[model samples]
Target: MMKVLLTGGAGYIGSHVAVSLAAAGHDIVCFDNLSNSRAAVIEHVEAITGQPVPLVVGDIRDRDAVRGAITDHGANAVIHFAGLKAVGESVADPMKYYDNNVRGTLSLIEAMVDCDVRTLVFSSSATVYGEPQYLPLDEAHPTAVTNPYGRTKLMIEEMLSDIAAADPAWRIAVLRYFNPVGAHDSGLIGEDPNGVPNNLMPFISRVAAGRLPELAVFGDDYATPDGTGVRDYIHVDDLAEGHVAALDRIRAQDDALSVWNLGTGQGYSVLDMISAFERINNVRVPHRVGPRRPGDVASCYASPDRARDELGWEAKRDLDAMCASTWRFERTAAMRNA
Candidate 1:
């Protein structure tokens, strides 16, 4: 029965993790700036959990606001997810990523320290591994980030490590995620990005829903079987549960800092994902193959063995489940908006 504060609780992954945490009998407070998300997400989460979650409309870069949220709710732990995401955006404006992802994390931790809430589960990305040196990237893989987005994540990881080393009282778990797709089974809450989505799954969903014209298959000439970039697309629900699992482990153990990769340990090319979505949902997704984007990798997946062994968590949903749920949510959202 931990009282947790989710920094970006109204966002896609944060909302799902909020539901998961509530189901696990934990109280949660969502602190978000609503920059890339909507306030209606808090209502949607309430609908899913049948429990009220406090929404604090604030930025993580504001230490006073963060501290107030933690102190006001008496939160015992923090799941830091308030940060800008999107590789192209990060590259176009590297300063924004540094200010939000890196500086925002520093501010959040400072607030946590002030509030004496040391347990944290950070949302990191596998992009830190960069262009994979080996297949099934493990935690020990050398981090040579290729883009500003990846650099921000790696910088935060290093910062957290240094912090935990300086103060053993701080318990932190960094989960490096692969691609997270799909939606909740209820179809009530899913990835609803503003404007053009930067990720593959949401972009595909929009294209299938007729909101977008076609999906751009970036880098079809990559050195893969299908000549497209391959990624490990874990279901969003599974990723949410992984956060809960990491939270549980950090709370139970005295380990100052722990890092785990949250992924399916399997690779799916861009074509493979498109084909799966079409086959599973019986829908056509119009797509066009364009030249490879800069800083794109040929293949990237995860080992996921550390999370399995340490946290006893593994992605359970299959590719079909991911596609079906995503399509279901897309249709449901379209109808509701109409």
Candidate 2:
């Protein structure tokens, strides 16, 4: 098993990936700043895996701390998930996004080079695709990000490409995730975004749990089948498994930079998702039609062919499972918080 250092490992996707890696018998060191996540998540991860994951509390931008964590843990690989992710927030403060996302990645890469650990699995987003030039976005789709959040992902992808080109020893996997939803089946941890959530599934969860009054169905006039925006929402566990698959593939390769989309290749409209949540959970989600936010797309999903054919991985969970798991987590988290 590989010794992997997970940056932002206490966060939603990071924590799930940590659990997956630990379950697969990998030694995991969780490094996080705790800026947007809680330290208690590490406890949940340990509880789920029945294995203690060492926590290194530090910022990714701190080169010394990053290097120390890598060297101290004897980490053979790094999974980068530390960054600002909100598109609206990124637009409001572009500098913050660039500094944390771009500069932070630079620091981590420098530390990796210093420690001679080259294998990397980067947490990228479909936002890098920007306004989808076509449906079922493939890795070959031209990248033209709309917001600063997306721009940072695109910039990091480019940076990794350049680094790989310069040094043949670097092995990188840029997993462009479409729309990651759901939580672990244990319902021990899930998406716990600070303040209001920017994504759809969490918002629906909150509304269903009565933490929020209602959901906002943005842009009902879009040209989708239901006139609402559509997205490919994959289960977080499935996405985490994709990371494990990526780590295995990258470890086997000598020198390669691979890009794959982790998604279901199926699009579900906003109303469709809400209906699924309500039907599955037997809860009413009061929602109203709202104006389309800036930089919002009508429909966005993934091709998922390359990841399937190459990495021997495909999303196995369906939409109903995603909704039910998220609602379960939301209720569990709410009770714990209470």
Candidate 3:
């Protein structure tokens, strides 16, 4: 098992991945700024894993802090997940995305180079593919991102590619996720974004829980089965397991840089998701159709052939599980807050 340093371990996906990594017997140290996360997530992760997860409260943009975390923990590999992820927010504040996502990644890379931590698993998004030229986007799809959020992810991908080409010692795996939803089966940790959420599952959960007045169904004019946007929503736990597989794959290789899409290889429209959630949980998620959000596409899913053939990983959770786990976590979180 690898001694890994998780850059955004207190956040949604990072925390889940932390549990998965621990289950795989890897030691972890979480380095987070607590910007988009809370300290209590570390405790939840520990409770689920029954292991102590050391947390280093520091910004990824701070090279010294990052290096110190690595050396202090004797981490040989890094899972980079700390970044601003809201697409609309990125469009509204391009500079913030650039500074936080792009610059922060650069600092992390430099620290890794200085410390000789060559193995890295980067958290990327499907937005880097831009508006799909075809259904089920593959890694070979042309990359022309439409928003600053995608641009930042693509920039980091290019940077990693360059670094890998320059030095053969770096073993980097870029897992471009489609859409992550749901929670851990334990319901001890889940996607609990700060303030207003930028993702769909949380919005639906809030609407169902009466925390939000209504869900904003962004655009019904898209050329899809239901006149709504379609995406491949893989459960967050499955996404987390994919990271563990990626880390294992890269470590076995002498030197490598690879990209894989972590998705379920199935598409679900917005309406379809709402229907499934309501049917599974017996709850009404009130929603209203609005104009399409900027940087959104008509249809975007993943082929998942590469990830399956290469990493031996595929998302296994069904839509019912996604909806059920989300509602379970929502109720659990509500009780905790109460």
Candidate 4:
């Protein structure tokens, strides 16, 4: 069994990936700073996975700490999910974005090199595609990041490619994820964004939970069926599974440093998502149409053919499942807060 080091393993996606990797029988060692996550998540992850989360509570910027985790755990690979993520927040604090996202990644790579652990699975984003040139964005689409957060993602993708080129010993999986919603089926461990959530699903959840006043339907004048932006929403479980599939590929020596999009290849408009959330929770969400936010695109979804063909991964959960799982998590968030 391989001992895998997962950076940001305490966050939403990393926690899910930790459980997924553990379920696949790989020993997990998580390295995290807990900036946007809670220590309690580790307990809940243990509850869901039926195993303890062996974690190294530290920042990715700390090279010595990263090297220690790699050497101490003998990690065969690292699935990196640690970084600043909010688009608006990134725009406001580009220096923090560069420091943590870009510089921190460089430090991690340095530590990995020193520790002789070359395998990596990076958490890229659809934001790299920026304004979609066309519907169902494929891997070949033109790349442009509209926000600083997206720039960090794009920069890392390029950096990984360069590092792999310099030394083929680096086995990397760059998974450009689409809209990730929903929670684990257990309803115990889920996304708990501290303050205001920048993404769609959590905002909806907060509104449904009565924590927020109303949902701001950004850009209701977009050229879509419902006059709203469209995105390909993928289940967190499927994305987690995709990471496992990527690890399998990396371990099996089939392909290294390959990139794939993790999505369902199905586009859902904002109104469609709201309707589905309402149907699943049996609650009417109060919302108002607002002007298009800066850097907001008209449509952006994924073409999942590459992930299906290459990694043998496909998003199996539908919109209903995504909404249902999110509502379940939302219902318990109050208890978690207290």
Candidate 5:
């Protein structure tokens, strides 16, 4: 087992990944600024794994803090999840996205190099592919991001590629996630975005739980079978397991940089997801047809062939499983917050 430092480790995806890493017998040091997360998430992780993962309260842009955390923990690898993620927010404030995502990643890389820690698993988004050139986006798809959030991910990918090219010792795995939904089966932790959620699943959950009044079905005029947008929503646990697989692959291979898409080879329309949530949870989700958001696409999913072949990782959970687990967590979170 290796000592790992997870930046933004208390957030939704990071928290789940931490649990998986700890369960896999890795010692973890969770570093985050708590910008979009909470300290309580660490407690949930510890509860799930029965391990007290150390928490470091600092931003990734703080080179000194990041370096200290890595050196102090004797971390040999890093999983980067610290960044601004909302596409709409990034579109409104491009500089914030560049500074937090791009500049912060640069700082993290510098610290890793200084400490001679090269193995890294970066959290990337499929939005880097922009409007899909074709269905079932493969890694070979040309990258042309639309919003500032995606641009930051693309920029970081390019930078990491360059860094790895210069140093053969560096090993980097860029996992481009499609649409990550659902929660752990234990219902102890789940997606808890601050303010209004930007993603579809969480918004649907909130509407079901009565936290939000109604769900906004963005544009039912798309060319999809159901007219609403379609996306490949992978379970959070499956996505976390993929990270564990990636860490193992990076450790065993001599490759400098590897990229994989973490997704199931299937797409579900917006109505499909809403219907699943309502049917599985037996709840009514009031929704209305809204105008399409500027950067919204008709459909997006992943091929998952490369990830399956290379990293021996493929998303296993289905859409019904995703909706069921999310509803479970949504109810639990509501009770806890109450």
Candidate 6:
């Protein structure tokens, strides 16, 4: 079994990927600071995978600790996912985002180089293709990040590409993910945001649980079928599988750098998602109209052709599955707190 080091394996997407990688027979060591995640995530991952996910509680910025973790775990590859992701917070504190996201990645890459772990699968975002000029954005779309979060992702993509160019031995896979929602099927693990969530599904779940007052529907005046911002909301499980597929592709290649869009090749507006969640969860999500935030796009979806052809990965879960799994997670979270 190949050893893999997951930078943020305790977080939402990272835990799911850790489970997936373990199921595929890979030894994983998660390196995280626990700044945005819970320590109980290890139990959830073990319960799901039926194996312990070795923990290395440390920050990616700690070059010595990161290098030691790689050596101790005997990691042959690194999946970098440790980064601050709140868009609003990034705007409010761009330097914090830059230091944590950009500098963290650079430090991780440097540690990987020191540890001789050249294989890497970076967690990128579709926000790099800001304000889509086209309907279905391909990998060729222009990257114009309007937010600090998006800028961090775009800048890292450039850094990875340049690194690969300099070193021929590095086999890198940059997976530009779409809006990843939902949770694992078992409901043992899912997103556990520290405070009020900034994402759409989490907000909706909170509203259903009475934790939040109401869902603030941001701008129904956008030019779309339902007059709401449309986005490619891929299931978190599918997104996790995409990471596995990317690793598989990276292992097969002798010396090559690859990038693919991880998405379902479909678009759903804010209203569409709310309706789908309501139908699946059987709960009324109270919401109110709100002003449109700046840098908000009308619509953005992935083509997924590159991922299909390159990595042989396709998002299998539908909207219903996404909603059901997410609700299951919410139920579990409520029970745990109780």
Output the number of the lDDT-best candidate.
3
The sequence of per-residue lDDT tens digits that candidate 2 reaches over residues 35-147 is 88999999999999998889999999999999999999999999999999988889899999999999999999999999999999999999999989898899999999998
Which regions of candidate 1 fall more than 4 Å away from where they truly are?
none
Ranked by lDDT, top first: 3, 2, 5, 1, 6, 4
For model 4, how big is the CA root-mean-square deviation? 1.2
Worst 10 residues of 3 by lDDT: 250-259
lDDT of each: 0.93, 0.94, 0.95, 0.89, 0.93, 0.90
lDDT of 3 by residue, 1-338 (tens): 89999999999999999999999999999999998899999999999999999999999999999999999999999999999999999989999999999999999999999998999999999999998998789999999999999999999999999999999989999999999999998887899999989999999999999999999999999999889999999999999999999999999987669999999889999999999999999999999999989988899999999999989998899999999999999999999899
lDDT of 3 at 277: 97
Output the better candidate (3/5) by lDDT. 3
Candidate 2 lands at a TM-score of 0.98
lDDT of 1 by residue, 1-338 (tens): 99999999999999999999999999999999998888898898999999999999999999999999999899999998888888888888999999999999999999999988899999999999998889989999999999999999999999999999999998899999999999999888999988899999989889988889999988777789989999999999999999999999988888899999999999999999999999998889999999877667899999999999999999999999999999999998888888
Model 3: how far is 203 from its true place, Å?
0.8
Candidate with the larger lDDT of 3 and 6? 3
Off by over 4 Å in 5: none
- Per-candidate clashes, comma-separated: 0, 0, 0, 0, 0, 0
TM-score of every candidate = 0.99, 0.98, 0.99, 0.97, 0.98, 0.98
Pairwise TM-score winner, candidates 3 and 6: 3
Tens-place lDDT per residue, model 4, 36-109, is: 98888888889888887787899989999999999988887899999999877888889999999999999999
